[model samples]
Target: MEVETENKYLEPLFQDGSLYQNELKCDISEKISDILTTITVFGSVSIETSQPAIIYKSKKKIQAQILSAIPHHPKSIDTISISLRSKLPFPAISQSSFRGFTVSPSGFIVLSDTSQRLGIMNSCGTYDFIKKGLNSYNDITFVDDITVAASTINAIEIINLDSKLTERVISFHGICYGIRYYNGKLLCSVISKGIQMIQLSNGQITDLVKQREPENWSYLAIHDDKVYQTTSNYFVRCYTMKGEMLWEHILQQSKGVARGITVDNNGIVYIAKYNGNSIALLSPDGQRCRHLQISDTKKPWGLHFNAITNSMTVGCVNGTIELYDISYSH
Candidate 1:
């Protein structure tokens, strides 16, 4: 017997020209029978009566298609909670002026500072420094599994992690502060130029947002189709990829200046309060907020959350790097 199928063109994953990076979670407790009933158009389940019925019935309760579970979108979550796990020992750097850092999918970290070198390390205390063809590093982001792009005074350099060599350089008229990689493009903050997008393949640059007075201390993060940014004025603004501002929030004067900004797997915004000595968590809708106190340090400058391991990496202005495990509750 042959099964006939029609040729139907599938739509692009992101239909509205927006980038979506929602992580999918599997529910091992879900039974195939339940999945069938839930997916049936009329809410009916047909019995699978065949020669293998008896054998399948014996293991019906057993977990099947565990990896094929439906996606669990955290946007539907009502509340969230966080706690600091044991801090991983980050190797100390002498006379370090930390700027930013990014964590790769495999847990490797690459940190940039205002020095002539970039520090590459992991949570296990393994660390190394790359010091060739570099003047001053400001912000850094991972390009791929074994490559990273770092911004400097007036340019962005792409370097290989394994070889630790500058593969290419993307020059700019002004200083590039914060940088992030998404969907084969680099979103950058160039002083006086606002938010810009770079095409990695052809090096074409396009402006996403026009900044009247672009601040040098601004940072940005992307979640799903939205971009969250923080400015030196302690203002956090959410914008679409086309530069449409959706909502904005200004940190209370007591919370200090917002320096580092990141969005977790659940779409919650986390801002590092540099002088406030705390991390502020903003709800997805930008309506509610809570704080995570930092007793050990007061100058958090960079933040990166790893959804795979449920951990976060914090880089302080004093060159202190710490990894924290985040626990969430509904």
Candidate 2:
């Protein structure tokens, strides 16, 4: 007996005229399913091999299609279908729009809303706690299981989840957009001032990278020993732990505003484009691999990668969140 195969081409619609002039396309050989998923004209699709899933925006919702029935022998993909398991309509964190989001190691989601509220969503996607009266919380990261540090305009606050007490840990004179906590230190991206490392113990500030010509960074992510930052000038740069430049890659369709950056365990960089309504993946060495369009997202802001579950959650400007099962193999 012989197995049959079919070639399927995934192409961007480009209907909104936001896609770059270079046509983005991918070819996959697989057995097509009769049950079609409704995808919108301006959505993004992420193909991952680690978990063998394809996540895309369909209409106003995001759906995950899991690929199964892989032949043990050398063969193409046979019978792709949508898995009944999915996360839809993430529990509302606030009445206002969400500006930042991060997932704790224990699987809880920390989100900041435009109305000065910080919310914690449990693994089941239900709000566990909501803390109000914050000063425009921008981004959040866990300093510990019961403690989280968040960024405001020019300050970083350490909040105790159990008691709901917020303390200003570090304050600077520049605008801070992105932050990450690691090894008792906080790495932050300050506009026009480059990246800064703050000692969590003493609240001491040290410049990691000074501002250079033509670009100011607003997003930061660290993987292994390397630190990553995305700039307002359409560039993604990598630096050593000692503040040495490694490589930089300029995005194809970025219109001078880039936000929401995260690095996977494999060192692949995923960034959200504020003006392009898209997300781009870059290789560890700064190579453009693929670009995805998120139709329902405007100015996608927060990007968080859950290493434990291999999931990526994105917060958009319209107060909605999209979660994807990111496969790291591919």
Best by TM-score: 1
> Tens digit of lDDT per residue, candidate 2, span 1-330?
122121112223333333334334565424234225442233444543332134334432222333334433321111111111234243554443667878887777888877788888776667755687547887888988888888887788889888888855577878777888889999888877888899987888999999743243377888988988888657788999899999988877534267789977667778887767777777778854567666666667778777887677777766666677664221
**Alpha-carbon runs more than 4 Å astray in model 2:** 1-96, 212-217, 254-256, 296-299, 328-330
Spell out the clash pairs found in candidate 2.
42-295, 43-293, 43-295, 44-293
TM-score of each model, paired residue for residue: 0.76, 0.68
lDDT for 39 (candidate 1): 43
Give all candidate RMSDs, comma-separated: 14.2, 22.9
Q: What C-alpha lDDT does candidate 2 achieve relative to the native structure?
A: 0.70
lDDT of each: 0.75, 0.70
lDDT winner? 1
Note the clash tally of each candidate.
0, 4
